[model samples]
Target: MSSPLRLILFDVDGTLADSQGAITGAMAEAFEGAGLPVPPRDAILSIVGLSLPLAMRELAPGQDAATVEALVEGYKSSYMLAREAAGAGHSPLYPGAREALAELNAIPEYLLGVATGKSQRGVEALIAAH
Candidate 1:
């Protein structure tokens, strides 16, 4: 008899990878590039699960749409540059994450996937890097 499949979905940021450094760094660069005050680290982290456009709006409320769009683009470019520079080390996996994924993969009944607010390209880069 075939075993029933059990799917496991892991969050890309915070859960599988400790991406706070990259996230906060990109946020700061984006805000600064827009001539806006950079938010506190805690504030930036608070928006981790939000999509980039939504996060940008939350961070820079009351701004014109152009400013919000600029922040989003700035963040995306900054993050991409950092990822290119750092490669796999851009966002190191949390301790034991590699082992955990391997262990799960070894189980025939288990299937793993990622759920994240990141763009498809961003997720692809992360996967390719690791």
Candidate 2:
């Protein structure tokens, strides 16, 4: 008899790997690119799960929609450039994560996947690098 299937979804940042440093750097770059003051690291990290536009809105409250969109674009560009510069080794996996994942993936009932706030391209690149 075949085993029943199960699914496991993972978040990218601060979960599978530590991308906070990269995120902070890109966020700062984005804010500067948009001619806005860079928010503190805690403030940037707080809205990590939000979509890009919404995150930009929270970062630059009271800003108009156009400004938020520009900030989002800048963030995306900075983040992509950073990932391209560093690659799979950019973000380190949690300790023992490789062994754990291998153990989990060995089970016929388990299937792992990702559910991150990162753009599809970002996630793919991160996966390729790390």
Q: What is the C-alpha RMSD of each candidate to the true structure, in Å?
A: 0.6, 1.1
Error of 1 at 81 (Å): 0.4
Superposition error at 105 for model 1 (Å): 0.5
Per-prediction TM-score: 0.98, 0.94
Q: What tens-digit string does per-residue lDDT give for candidate 2 at 1-130?
A: 9988899988878888888888899899999998999999999999998998889888899999888988998988888888788876667788987788889999989999988888888778776775
Deviation (Å) of 104 in candidate 1: 0.2
Instruction: Give the CA lDDT, 0 to 100, for residue 8 in model 2.
Output: 93
Best by TM-score: 1
Report the CA-based lDDT of candidate 2 relative to the real structure: 0.86
The runs of at least 3 residues in candidate 1 whose Cα sits more than 4 Å from the true structure, single-residue gaps closed, are none
Best by lDDT: 1
| TM-score of structure candidate 1 | 0.98
Lowest lDDT sum, 10 consecutive residues, model 1, at: 114-123
Against the true structure, candidate 2 reaches a TM-score of 0.94
lDDT (0 to 1) per candidate: 0.95, 0.86
